[model samples]
Target: MDLLDDESSAGASNAPEFSVSELSGAIKRTLEGAFGRVRVRGEVGRVMKAKSGHMYYDIKDDRNVIACTTWKGQVSGLGVLPEEGLEVIVTGKLSSFSAQSRYNINVDTIEVAGAGALMAMLEKRKAQLAADGLFAPERKQALPFLPEVIGVVTSPSGAVIRDILHRLRDRFPRKVLIWPVAVQGANCAPEVTAAIAGFNQFTPGGALPRPDLLIVARGGGSIEDLWGFNEESVVRAAAASDIPLISAVGHETDTTLIDFASDKRAPTPTAAAEMAVPVRLDLMAWVDGQEARLSRALAQGIGQRQQHLRDLSRALPRPETLLNTAAQRLDLWADRLPNALRAGIQSRQVRLAQAGLRANMLRNLLTTGQERLTTLDRRRPAALTRQVNTARRHLTATTGRLRLSLLQQDVARKSEAYGQLSRRFTDLARAQLQGRRNRLDTLDRLRETLGYQATLARGYAVVRAGDQVITTKAAAAKAGSLEIEFQDGRLTPQMEAKAAKSRKKPDTPPPDQGTLF
Candidate 1:
């Protein structure tokens, strides 16, 4: 109740008052005006992408944190997308949302804070990928000794690709397929990944042959400039590639995550080319050397075989000596041939005389044969009659089995079944034909209902110029001669003119002309 208290209360009452919305707005404006644009270096936390494609995340330090947002349109242009626990430098304008009563940054670009941050992220990613066995030696494929087609993924404008080509040409000329891509940008990872997958999609014997070896090459650059190769997407793609891949991302001193994932790693782009093919001169020299060795071995083998043949021949007896005994035996046999023949003839003559084989013995044999013939002739008629009786019985039995009535019955049964089947077939064919006719009629009706002629029946006339119908007034105006079609018939320009003439009243002859005035 003091006078000073009253003065203080009255002063407080005179102070300005604001609604919730106005106060929030005023604060937002002040905050935005104070920090229009800024670059904040902090560790990203709780990274998220909205369904609307805007990225939402928090950038925090030990003391405080700030909410950050990257609109969908600007996300792609960012050098790197923010991940949780990643320290990044964010560049953006400050913004405040009155509804949320909080200030946040509308991020324009985001990148790793420095090489240390990048290395830390790279190490984390490397550990994760290594745990997944992407760097396992057993998963790697051996490169082809000489690939028919070599696919290169690099920027076409860069000197790296030119160096690779030049090196390849100098070593051994090969068919090179260039899949041009951005080597160092936000687009680099996606484009290079897609190139690897696209090369794998080619059919082996297709018009564009599949590459036997893949070489992903890029020139030397700083860690940040070569970060696209370190991207998770690029590393994953390299590890998953079915084709043998050689990563030549940076100089020997500059290592990237892709080097560990690739099937082989080259220190430089030129080194990658060297790994892809062997020197032609060296290959030719090796081939010549192998040919010479093979020829010498062949000559040595032939000489050894000839020497063995001569040794074997020395152990064998001479042909004349081996045949000497056989010749002597042959001569002895030939000398005794005439005497043996004469002795055999004399012994055969003596045996013939002792046996008494003469004309009387022949007559006795003839008499015995005549007696045997007489006995056989006596039994012939009886055998012939018995055989005839057997043949007759067989014929009678066979004739009895062939009854005409049975054959007629079988024929009638078959004929009835055939007629039934034929009738059924005829009925089925007629039904199918009727169904087809009904379908055809329905289609014809549908065609008529949908056709423009049906529209003409409803008081609409179609104006045609030649065979084409004119639907618009502009088209009708352009038509030199109109053919108007109604449901009844078409009225051509000539027909219309004739009808107008017929409808016109006969021109009244000029009175002066008719009256001869």
Candidate 2:
């Protein structure tokens, strides 16, 4: 037994050991061989997307979690990205990442678990977006009656595009810009978003004419196939687009989020094309009808105006009759002019005869007045000489009295003015001296009130450290010594160690405050 055990121990000691990487690779090959392809049903969780166009996420059940990865090439075919909390069935081969030393699913196909779950998700997203006013009627734009250029977003090879072009051509031929894109897959949302944004980014009248209207169209399909149009990315892109958009994503019964966001919703791509342009024949007929109505209205208006002008012309008097009346009045005035001149001359003659009679009466009155003047002239010389001597003596006495009164009044007025001036000067000098005395007294009182000695006398002391006044306890604690000034004198206070520590509480009242006086 000892010999057998020794041989087994020697063999165990000689066995080879594998490194971490070698063991991981071996496990990877074993898992790949055992479960080459698998189908897992679980709720999605913790989805992470790499910038390299690769997605990494986990699918979890009540008890277990499995990591999943989808490469870029396969991602475009994924109708919808696996969102967190979404229940889906993943179909792919089980593979191990040797670098991470972990096993995961390399997913190639993902689908919602059931119709019920998909409907529930759709309803939830619809309610969430509807609450955000994405479907507001006020936000919908009016489609252009006739667009110069119509941009279509659909698969280039699909019959949907052909249907739209045919309908547009039949109604009214227009410039059609085709932006080929995936209509119902993982790439659909992003492609649609980019196309809508590209149309908006165009500068009008540039190398590429900016579209006046846009049509987002696709053929009818199952809910799963049409889900890309319902994606938040595509819906938001449509809502944010500047150009008027028409959504013809599926059959009339198929509703999507893009339908709510689009400016107009058409039952089919052909219907969308019809909405984008008006019928050329119908428009021409409408224009013709308007032209006929305008012509009739203009002719009727001109006839009415002509009839009114004729009525006004009949109401006015004839120009010849008016001139005949004027001529008759002129002839009558001409005949009366000579008779008026004769009457004027006769009145002047009567006025001249009255003037001659008045002159004769004046001559008789003048003769009477001259006879009376000769009687008074003989007695005038003797009376005038006697009156002149008496008048001269009275004038001399009146002149002497007037001179005496004038002299007395001048003397009295001068004496009174001199006395008043002397009194005013004395009063002014007294008032000026009083004002100066009062101002000097007020200045002296103000000086005494503002003086520091006055504040000290009021039970306040100025504490100084060197030349600076110490207003706070912190300054006193920092100083080696302090000089306290009172109204009577100054004293030097020595700071104790306890006082320095007590100064920490600056808000506390000083212990020697009561004894400061």
Candidate 3:
């Protein structure tokens, strides 16, 4: 306590505080241990990367921000290069350096975060609404084919109101009333619901004119900021409305639950306006078109009637003498035949000459009948030919009987000889040959029983791998060809099956060898 304590106190008083380098090292170590791996999301700006394997950037929100740094090695594998003015989420070890007396995230991963989560949330909400029948085509009330008074629900001061108003004014400014709404933030749901209710209700003074169609709309924003239209109350209010609701919320790509529940969805406020009112010019054009079509139809009808009248006139007949006309036509044909025949007779004289020659030949033959018979009698050789034919027939009959008698005697001798030879033979040789034939037939039948082609015909199957027949369990040890044989042909199935290991046969004891024991 005397010398050493005094000296120690003096040293403590004189010694400088811990160096900045030491403090920084301690802080970095403490932070690394405290927040090993964390995820942070913020807007990115002023991204500066050092060649010494370090990256620096500012992580800002709407109100405040902080400088952030990530070692190059940690963020090298991130597919996207860090850029200014992109909202991103960074995951890394949290570290602090006492030397600089500052803390930064040592980013390990980085990506656009809100888009994926927002997409997922939107998809979930859409699915829920779809299941609830809010998105059913049946639930979507058809827009009054010609809505008279269109109602508008949007921000009173936003560009959306101006856009909707401008479009309505330019196109069909006949009479539209915009029911102002809080389209963003916590109060959005209640405000929109009330606006819709007010339109639907029977209210008195200060009430906006009743609208047959209500337009619910907004401009595009971040998913969170645009989430008010996706709220349950807003959707229910839209679905409950008797007045048809038209939703023009956000950009074309932006989807919300209210869009599904509403009667129709317009991509933007301007589109909603267009949908709510028919263009004056377009209506005028349509009226003209209808008028033209009516004119064309009337003309076609008149022309068709006139043509019908002309056809009837030509087909009609007066009460004149139809019978008299038919009688005259018949009498006119009766005197025409003889004249027709005379005009066709240029070769009749040659035909008459031939007829005369045929008549002369017949007369001459009749006059020489007896002379012709005498000449035939001189030509005849003898009448004994008939007798010769009779005697030859009798001789042939006698020879035939003799031949039949000889044939019987020969057959009797042959039968006796055959009986003697066969009595001395046995049936054993014939039976043995027949048994061998039966065995070969049995083997052929077995092959046909299990053959792949035969089995296919029999409505059975054989799964084969390559060229191998796969006759036994051992042959199909590997999966390969995968051919599926059918009745018509074989097909290689796109899918393959692993070869199953057949169960091993139980081992049998060695044959007994104790015969001499």
Candidate 4:
């Protein structure tokens, strides 16, 4: 046996030998060459994230276990972070760490292995959050119609933030405060939660403007990438936010726990901006339409009033026409009275002459009468003249008095009628004027209530791109620039380049554009 060993050693003296590092390196190369990039399915175990931003974990099946490491750069993009006991599929390259002298996988990506396990976990979390009353509809707050300051929790460098800002600029330009945070990974949840709480801490009207609304946004990705939003801390923070919060974590189909906790859930980041403000041109056009309607109503009312006045005038008798009949009657009475007196005097004279011619005995009477007549003849002329003059004077005096009395009575009657008619006309005019005034006032109030300016006065704002109003996120994105109109003034905010890039991944197609005016 000794002679055989000596012969073998002599024969193998020229053979190459390897050091520990060399052997390890050779083994690593061989493993990489054989497997290259591999997909390993297993249940996660003993996961630990290091302070150096690297992740260390174990993946094991019932019979075998393998160690895995994900560097910080790859961790951000990993759709899901590994948790103990979670079933997952890890894709990575097999390599050896010479210092540790052990083989491990350098993970490139990780994802939930099957839909069933993911759903179970999601259901469990959802049930827990529901039991906590975080998903109750009554717990939600109302979003502002227009926010003066918008707070955003997202990765400042990611496309999600850019998309949100761009959408806001297009919908309504507002002051935006950014709280940079990790969108995904172990650190993502706490940072997001802290950001939400920090925004609430800002004092309103202070040097640092407080947010009226908060937007927790992220771009569309796989379930793992969006898992941070489903974390209990993030969900709780969203539910507890004093400022109204909007969750725009992913595409419409991707829903997270935060969606239920938020006041509103936007299918996409851009959609959140649309929910914030109204189109400026559309509002102005609506105001103009209301004004025109009010004017038409008032004009029609005035025309109706004028027609009523004309009808009233036609129904009333004319003053001059009524007085004419009274004047005619007075003239007829004046003409007949003097004639009647003259006829009575002539008849008496005729009777006296007939008696004188009757008899001789009457002749003595006649002779005496003649003597009387002769004696009276001297004074008769004077007496007759005096009696005629006295009768004429009395008749003249009576006629004058009768005419004067009739004139006064007729004048009084006509005057009283005129006064009554005047009073009635005045009352009618006043009533009509009052009714018109009331109607006009009512119309004015209606106009004010329906006007867009009134809405603006109630803390709303309008958004415009150039002369056009941006009614949708797509339209705003296409516009590239925008103007926000408030009750007091207009603002145009500068958009970042990141926002432009985010427009490329819109979940919905752009809507048709139309003129507001």
Candidate 5:
């Protein structure tokens, strides 16, 4: 038994050798080869979309769970995005990532598993959007009465576009901008969303005119075919559009999320066009009716005014009848005019005589005025003298009432004030004089301390050659005569030498100036 065990161990060791990477690669190839493509039906588990645009999720049944991955490029093509607790069918190939050493399905397309699942998702999404107020009635816009340019969002090759164009032509024709887009399938939502946003981006009066109105139309279809319009992106784009939009995505019985979010909803594509504009024929007929009514009203008004004018003419008097009374009065005045002139001449003569008498009265008044002026001149000097005498008497009376004691007291107070002021002035003068003396003494001391004499007394000296003081040896050498000064006296170089000879030692004090003299 021991010999067999050793042989079996040697056989097992020689069987094969593989690194971890090689082993994982082999398993990956086997998985992809065995199940090249598959359709998986299960309820989606946790769904996570990375910032890198890759989607990672799980599909699970009663006990088994399968990992799934959808690349960024493939994500947009998905018919129904996987959600937690939603049953879906995913189509892709089975593959294994060597780095993770785990097997997963590389999902290419995903869709709701059944009608029940689709309806459940739609209801869930509808509730969420309603909660966000995207479906609020207040958000709806009023469509233009007549749009100058209409932008249509629909499949270019579909009957829906043809129907809309035909209906618009039959109604009030307008400039139409057709934005071709896929109406159904995985590309539907993104294309429709882009179309809506693109239409709104146009600048008004630009090279391409911006649409006053937008129509998103599609022929009648089942819920599955119309599912793209129910996408959150499509619904939000419709809701947020600045241009007034009319959604005609399905038949009258078919409803979509866009219908709720759009500015208006039409039962069919053709119906949306009709709502966009009024009937041209009807508009012209109404205008003609209004013009006719205006003309008839204008003519009736003119006729009524003419009849009223005739009635007013009957009440007015004739021109000749009005002038007759004035003419008769003029003739009567003409007959009396000469007599009135004669009386006026007599009256004027009487007035001239009265004026002559007034001239004499004025001459008498001038004489009286001259006499009065002379009298006033004579009285002026006497009145001025009397006023002056009266003022003198009043002053004498005022002086009589004065008290001698009060006057004496006033004089005493004045003298006391003057004496006090003089004392203060004398004290101030003495202080000022003392301050000046003190300052002068300080200045004198400062001067003495700074003087050369004071420096010489402190064992220093100033050498002099005549008026110039010799400070350096070079200056002394250049001088005609050199003099050296000690603290006690000034000496010529010859005298210094003689004094050194006479001195007992070099350290001896110099002779005094008085001694030198």
Candidate 6:
């Protein structure tokens, strides 16, 4: 039994306590000297990365964040940046940093416990920038619709590059130049600031003109991944640059102080890409519509010209109508002239015939008048003498009757004168009777002396031709026969003229006076 007890004691003394490296490491990870699985809420300060690819930062809450380190490979997939005043929950073993020999948490798995913690620090920074008027709307830039050059501050090799390319290809398809920049991590702010400045300087003399728009973009991640855009220097560079900027640094749900400072904000890199370019199909449709309108205008102009020509045609004059009217007038004149001339000739001929008949009648009447005047001259004086003698006889009878009546008015004168008057009257009557008988006998003798038939009976001759007496001696002597007139019978005489030497002369008779009554 004493030997069993001795074996138990000896085995217990041989048992392993711990290796010194393990002992010190375990001792370093404890409740008293270690900060174990505790949640720290603070703002980050002095954020850094070592050459071995480890990230170190302090966790602060308005004042501090204890020092901590994450191995390069472990934090390689963080897809975010660690920065000052970042709040997180760290699960790790506490250990000494050899350079300062100071104890700190070697971070294992870390999580962002209070995102508002970081926001509180960012809000304070935002207020400071606002008080300085750095984030004022007036301080912001304006974006260009058609940019000749585009500067991008984002991960060098990321999906953001492809997104912008796809958008440019579909929209503008113009020449573009890209400048690579860091999108996240400790060096992101300075690197982005440098890239913006370098692009500005190089833009003046480069193949591409200076950027009209600057697009800061990155793939989606935690808020820390997009924090580079929040840095004051990066923001001021974006604002101060001559170019306009588009902030597309995070997912649709994320927002930052840089968004207010930019000229425009996009939900994501893809959204930024879409905003930069236009669609090609819409331009083609507009060109086709313009062509159709031009074609319609040409058609309308042609129609107007055709109507004008039609109007002009109607207004033109017709020479044929004027000629036809003139011809009709000429034909009317041709039909009337000959008839008028023939009628005028017939009227003139009829007038000439009438005038000739009137002239012949006048000539015959003149010849008859001359013959009547000759007969009247031969007989008119003798008839007037007989009428005068009868008138004298009537006057003598009337005077005698008037005297006889006046004397009968006194009986004594009648008786006394009657005896005387009877004797005287008887004697006177007897004498008057004898005188009247003698006068009557004388008138009978004168008749016998002047009558042509009585002169033929008394052996007288009258030679006449065509009722005219022959009075000339030569006319009577050369005649073959002469008419002899007597008181009772007429005889034709043989008229012989004696020779000129045998002719005898006759004696002259005495003159007588007219008898008184």
Candidate that beats the other on TM-score, 3 or 4, i.e. the better one = 4
lDDT of 5 by residue, 1-517 (tens): 9999999999999988999999998999898888899999999999999999999999999999999999999898787898898999999999998897788999999988889999999999999999999999999999999899999999999999999899989988899999999999988999999999999999999999999999999998899999999999999999999999999999999999999999999999999999999999999999999999999999999999999999999999999999999999999999999999998988876765555555455445545655665575577558656755665555555544355455545556756765576567556655655565555456456555655778888888787888899888898878887776776777788776778899855587887667554
What does candidate 6's lDDT look like per residue over 229-321, in tens digits?
A: 777887777667667778887889888777777778899987887776556677678779999999999999999999999999899878897
lDDT of 4 by residue, 1-517 (tens): 9999999999899789999878888888898999899999999999999999999999999999999999988886676778788889999999878788788999988878888878777887899889999999999999887688999898999888788778777656889999999998768887999999999999999999999999998988888678788888889999999999999898999999999999999999888777766665676788899999999999999999999999999999999999999999989989998998898878856654443343334334434644554464466457545755665555556657777577556656756765576567557655655565555556456555656779989998889998898888888888878888899888776653556777777589788999999
CA displacement after TM-score superposition, residue 42 of candidate 6 (Å):
5.6
C-alpha local distance difference test of each model: 0.86, 0.85, 0.72, 0.82, 0.87, 0.68
Candidate with more favorable, higher lDDT: 2 or 6: 2
Which 10 consecutive positions of candidate 4 have the poorest summed lDDT?
354-363
Q: What shift in Å separates residue 266 of candidate 6 from its native position after superposition?
A: 1.2
> For residues 211-314, what per-residue lDDT tens digits would candidate 1 score against the true structure?
99999999888888899998888889999999999999989999999999999999999999999999999999999999999999999999999999999999
RMSD of each: 38.8, 42.3, 38.2, 45.7, 34.6, 44.0
Candidate 4, 133: how far from true, in Å?
Answer: 1.5
lDDT of 3 by residue, 347-408 (tens): 55455555455445544553364355445444432433453455455455656767756655
Off by over 4 Å in 2: 1-19, 50-54, 71-74, 96-102, 128-134, 314-517
What would the TM-score be for candidate 6 when compared with the true structure?
Answer: 0.39
User: What is model 1's C-alpha RMSD?
Assistant: 38.8
Error of 4 at 55 (Å): 17
Model 6 residue 78 CA deviation (Å) reads 16
User: In candidate 1, what residue range of length 10 has the lowest lDDT sum?
Assistant: 354-363
Model 6 deviation from the true structure expressed as Cα RMSD, one decimal place: 44.0
Candidate 4 regions exceeding 4 Å error are 1-115, 298-517
Q: lDDT of candidate 6?
A: 0.68
TM-score of each model, paired residue for residue: 0.59, 0.57, 0.38, 0.42, 0.59, 0.39
